[model samples]
Target: GPQGPRHLRPLLDTVLDALHTGTHARGGPLPTGGPDTVTAAVHDAAGDLLPDRGDPDALRTLVHAFAAGAADPAHPLCAAHLHCPPLAVAAAADLAASALNPSLDSWDQAPAASALETLLTRTLARETGHTDGLVTTGGTEANQLALLLARETHGTVRLVHGANAHHSLPRAAWLLGLPDPVVVPAPAGTLDPVALDDALTRLPGPRGSVLVAATAGTTDTGLIDPLPDIAARCTAHGARLHIDAAYGGALLFSDHHRAKLTGLDAAHTITLDLHKLGWQPVPAGLLTVRDAHDLAALHHRTDYLNADDDTEAGLPDLLGRSLRTTRRPDVLKLAVTLKTLGRTGLGALVDQVCAHAREFADLVHDDPRFHLHDRPAISTVLFRPAHAPDPAVAAVRRHLLTTGRAVLGRARADGRLWLKATLLNPATRPDDLRALLTLVHRTHAEGPR
Candidate 1:
């Protein structure tokens, strides 16, 4: 009898090599000069060459290079839009979720994940004074689901949004197979209940079956629509009220901003993005409804999936309520983050970010070069060169990104291109923002010229 030959050499060598490799060095101020080369070097035989395929190490290196060149949201200087660098604890949770690979489609497959998701969704609904909801991939999906549910619940004829509502609202309407949404212009990114009444009044048919949407936080202007008045009108007109609080939902935890979302508790449905204001990892959005049965009309089941008998028995499944399949366990990240940072801490973080936004707005207002759109209600600061002509302002905005200067944003507002900044990081300070603004001005002044 012969013992099997030992083939442990490769494993041992790999472990030893990994140990010797050490860690990545702290590179000097990120090379704003860009990489020396953009193309992948395929000929290098440095490591992991697969005879039939390609060099694995080289492929990995090339991919890393590309990803590194992309925007690093976590960077101290990277503040562009709603996306922010996640907290370290949440990132760790995300890593754990990826490793566990929970699907949440069924209890048998993901019992803990399903339970946790249900609990988290319930908690969120309670926070908004709603009774039912589900986690979504982002604010867009949440808003879409809210509108879809509203359409089914009340048989609404028309969908309406304040002019300043996020683009996602109309996008949601189009996605739900509805006609172009009826948009009423807001005076200053804050929905006017009177304008909404007028829009409903002018509609071709009975406006009783309309869905009027009020934005809790308008993206560019960070303004909250008059939710109480809008709710009252929706009730009087027999219309359904939907609030898109994707950006301002975090303010629920803020004493000062809670009043802005005063009527949210009365809305038929509402959308919120934990990733935006919750400071949780991305893909943590939620849609809540006042009644659980409102979602029954959208209930669907396949023979291979849950049948009516199973659903009647209360078998746990999220597939029928969502548009996605084989979805990631986003709830784990959200729950873990929330558990680590209690509601109070989370609320404080949101308050800090909003305060910073106001501070930045004041700084911009004081500077003759920059202009403020309006006093920021949430964490967004939209501005452009004060008194600069439309073309010049547009050029400055375009140059900021093109020249590798501070990354700001541009939007067509009030018939002009307005450069905007959204404070995504709660840790960001006014001094850091001032530095970013300085970089933006320098680039705008010199780059395009």
Candidate 2:
């Protein structure tokens, strides 16, 4: 067991070297020649997967290919989706987690990790004004769990979510076999309080028969639902509230922007994802519950793992913490990151990224060649080449993708397609934003080559 480092240290060097060489070889945000070319490169490098004899240099070869083809989020030009370049320390901690390979299904398998997770997750939960929380794979799992718990509390509940809500919420409801959800308008990009209140009142059901899903950070445009108004309506209409704050939840760390999420605590459940704003590696998500008693639904016992005698003898039962069995210790990286940065350090990072978005938006506004969407609610800025047809807007994005010049996303808002730049990199500078705009302008001018 202790000899793991001795064997892993050299392999670490090999991996690091491959990553360095690969990023340079890529030379841009993503690999050139687009998906087909990237596919060919991977096939060539992969060779035979199930060879009779194990290939000794497989690690080095594969790591290089993977990194070379990856759309690097750390690059200033790669501003797309909600992907963030993970912090170095968090990634390093993940390496240790992998080497140890502790599964969280039972305490006996991961005693120390189990204890550590309980402490870390509760502390995170309290930040959301909730009594307890569960570590989840990400936002999707957390959202699903929220719906499941609601259904358990009240049989056959209905989901009422804003049109701006994350797609996962309705999907989770449908997966749980709940009634079809009612959709409210988000005409101004944020959920309308009037529409939500009307929907809740019109739906004929007992109190707590409907679950209202609001969003703090939307996937398409990064807009937030009106939490206070939504929560108040839920209270009045006798409905439960679940806020999917997967994107905006990290604002709690930032003193500057936390005010935007003022009524967050009013919800019965809240979803938080650290991988988006906490700079952690993937699979870092948490769901908080206002009532700890709600978690009793998850309690399950299997004699081989979490035995009854083991629990009575002071062994902690880990089965009640999640819906999944055989989970990896994804908490290690999250713990390492939260401990390293604390509130001020993490808040500073949040502030910087938000500032970067505003700066880029201002740049777009000043230039006559581009049309800027409303200012960023979080760190997402939407803009399009001024007077360009929607087809040209789509083509410009593809042109950048094929040439490997930059990586940007597209979102449909206000009945038009706009190029989306989600600035999550704290290392981004003023020059980087300028350069990004310049690339977009030049690409549009090149006429879809």
Candidate 3:
């Protein structure tokens, strides 16, 4: 089904048009839109058929059409997920990687690409003060790799974590062959050492104690767990402590927020994603382990492919250490972004984003119509209608999506919906969030449901 030799001009034109005309110059559109209208517009944009006539021009047209239909998270007002307004340098690197079409499974296929990945992985591990790690596609894969490593090395069954750990942790368990992983509850989205101890007592400890996952920054509430305390308890209980810092690990360079990750050195493993807080393009996540020998368990091999002895020749294959075989060179973009932006630039950006998040929380603190759920720990503000009952959360969410005002965040805990805003753009001004708050007020007042 491969299309043979085609001119690259059309593809180039398509990509450029999507980047320029399809995306928002500032912030993206609001999350909610009329489903009927959205689908109708997209249908009209296409050539009125599911299967297009195999024309290159038509395909290019389809590309722009799809881009136009998708929401642009790069927009300034897009504070929904842990999405960043990707750096221009990183975006260029991504385009280069796609052009190269390198498969990182072996050195013969990807020589320089493999070497670049190796250096980037090592650099990231060093950044985490660790000796070994791999570049995963994203945080979910990194977390899965971390869990698999723990299971293979420690040989335990039970996993413990704060109640507010990202959904990926439980999903990681499911993917790694442990369907019923233990979930240890901690109050206020922060882990209580005593609660973990009690959990240890209730569950058969030492036998099933596989891994203890701690959050440096939780996804929904942006609260950091008592990591040092959790690490200490993990050591006392002989459990491998893995810090899921995917959302907060970028703070390592930020002078303002580094204190939040004070005890990260004590963790056995750490996961950080450049695509999230680091403001790099997607498909870059680092899983750094404290020890190199511990990572040997995940080194898979097969006779079908010849292993490269490049480490001896000053070039090592990164493919062996990763969970993915036909992997994309996700590291190049990070390396380029880091080199171009420098540590200070990125640190300042992080500070700017967090400052805006704090400003948002403060702005909503006493607003009679809205309630600030918790303080902005890193770069997120959890808020909802102050007067609206907890039951109205779902209705409000549905209504927001129906009107296409903003792409807001939604979380459900104990049967209550909590709305969150994850700030990643340094250009997102306080006034922009203020406008969102105004939109929320207007939307709530006009609720006909």
Best candidate, lDDT-wise?
A: 2
Better lDDT candidate (1, 3): 3
- What C-alpha lDDT values do all the predictions have? 0.73, 0.93, 0.77
The Cα RMSD in angstroms, rounded to one decimal, for candidate 2 relative to the true structure is 0.8
- What TM-score fits each model? 0.86, 0.99, 0.90
lDDT of 1 by residue, 192-240 (tens): 7898888777766454468888888877767788888988888777787
- Write model 2 residue lDDT over 1-449, tens digit each, in one string: 98889999999999999999899999999999989999999999999999999999999999999999999999999998899999999999999889888999888789889988988888998898988899998999999999999988888899999888889998998899898999999998888999998898799989999999999988877888888888889999999999999999999999999998989999989999988988888989999999999998899999988899989999889898999998899989988888999999999999999999999999999999999988999999999999999999999999999989999999999999999999999999999999999999999998955
Question: Who is ahead in lDDT, 1 or 2?
Answer: 2
Order of candidate numbers by TM-score, starting with the best: 2, 3, 1
Residue-wise lDDT of candidate 3 within 1-449, one digit each (tens)? 13422555567767787656544421246423567766776677675564644554665555665665655666655677987878888988887788777788877668888778778778778777898678888888888888888888767456677788878988888877774766777666687788887776676646435677889888887788988888777777667788999999999888888888888978888999888998787877889989888888867656344444544566445446777678877777888988888889889999998999988988889687887787889988888887777667656666766665566788654456777788888888767989988877777777657
Higher-lDDT candidate of 2 and 3: 2
Top candidate, metric TM-score: 2
Per-model root-mean-square deviation over C-alphas: 5.5, 0.8, 3.4
Candidate 1 to native Cα RMSD, angstroms: 5.5
